[model samples]
Target: MAKWKLYWVESDGYEDCFVVAKNSRSARSVEANMNGFDISDATAIRVMDIPDIFEEKADKKFRDWSKIHAPQQANNPDLHEWPWYADKWLLEELGAQFRVIDNEEQILLRDIVYAKKPTGEWYTYSIGARAIYERNKDLPQYDNYDNEPRIDISKQLYTAMGLALTQCHEIEFLFSNSFVFAVSEKQKKKYKTFNDFFKGWEKKTLGGLFSAMQEAFDIDPEVKMALDLFLDMRNTLVHGITTTERYDINTDWGQKELLAFLDLFLSLCDPIKDIATSCFEVSIEIANTYLLKESDENIPIKSSNELLSLFINCFKLKSMN
Candidate 1:
């Protein structure tokens, strides 16, 4: 048996991909064949040996489940027919998107490689730490007219700012869904009515959602404080950035201010991210609790009302920390 080795392959103008092959030559060949690039022009760096039993059982279980439940059409899947599966799919998709955005932000902050083009525009690229070092190692250092090194600080800050805002938006969406699940439980317990006050709640601002959540539950003070700080930073980036003349992207002083703002923004992201993570955890737990039977057998799916009790209970238990 040929032992598979992990390799990181990079080709010009193509997204880097990982391949499992017996050797570096095989890895390059695999990438070239997969991406329609010439093997001669591809660079393959051996990463490590592929673990034989990494998630083997889980992988087989998922494969079996997928074979049973896989949608027939790419876009026409009847996931909605199974509410539990639909919610599970949606949550997984959201988590994947969040991870991608978070990773892009980290790459921009750490592994970015950029240069000024002939057209006076900046070109920035990143392909993780190793690829970044490989590509940047041979580049000649250039300096500005004042003997200072030429650096695209503004572009980095601008990109980082955009990513930070995007992450905030994702967090808000997750928080909003969590609030709905929690509030739905409250309504069912108290009014015994299916009336949802938070319909079209996504249209509301994050501040409004925060207020509503506070009024609906005994939210942890630390969570509230973290969310308040996040909201303040998010609002400044969204609303105050254009009107505020102090933080200009065109000058060194303005760029410094922008960097400072971004630093603080990123610092606040950890706590907010923790809260979002808690929301996801509770939502998944609620789904598992109500959607699956104890014997791992499919039962008659209950109405959303029945599920709401556990949703709010899980939310309160997880969010209070």
Candidate 2:
């Protein structure tokens, strides 16, 4: 039997409670029996195991064991507070075990995992959620030696492809939008309206946009090289995958080629980060030089600045673990 520490919100605030039971359902049932109320809502009940040290204390009950380690209120140090239990108590001691009682939450906590690159950056995935669900739900256990590597590699390949494509799109959008602001009034007048101009430029291919940007700004050779390589791989992955027989999963040689491509895609992470950082810097420079100089009533300018800020924030979040 496990000593399950359960938490829920009451009429006023959070209720910090616990029960000793065989599993999560029984634990909730035990709590409901003692308190004379149903508490079986999976969404409301957060569960964790009471550490063995406290559970083994024969002299104290489960509630008493919890109170012994609960956080004290600021106004009265002697009074233990229930509201801080979720954030303070569990996070400080049993952080890993803390999760809501739901299948989705369980899958997120169990299936998703992160890996830190040598550069101290982190990336995560749910180990191919769709593929795992379609192939076999139990495959996520990752204990089958024969199938694990193939699934793991395939998932990583798809994940890397997604990251590459997303970053490339962002780069293209940033440069294309910034180009609109940087161009002279005469150049802008070629289009019927601002929307038309923006849409026309936005429709340009990644290579075409980069080429246009080169006319105005000195492109970093390394950044250009990395992006060009990414565009090439993106084409092969997106277009060639449907047309060519180069990536046949049924053949050993094609399988080797696919695995090699996965390795190459994974290797682009450092360069991709560098190029993204460069694009962000250039976009900021363009905004500061032209967009921000426009009158306050210029709605497009204001919207562009807001979009840039949001992109920066999102990039920061992804860059962190």
lDDT values for all models: 0.54, 0.46
Q: Each model's RMSD to truth, in Å?
A: 26.1, 18.7
Off by over 4 Å in 2: 1-156, 180-196, 292-321
lDDT of 1 by residue, 1-321 (tens): 325555556676334554556687877787677678889988876544444443243344445566667735323433222101112233222221111121232112222322333443333444332332343566453222123344658678778888888788778877766543445344345443223433545556788777666655666666667778888989888886734554657744346456656766776886676566566555555556774668785433334543444344433532432
Model 1 ranges off by over 4 Å: 1-152, 184-198, 240-243, 287-321
Clashing pairs in 2: none
Best prediction by lDDT: 1
Best by TM-score: 1
Worst 10 residues of 2 by lDDT: 100-109
How much is 49 displaced in model 1, in angstroms?
A: 55
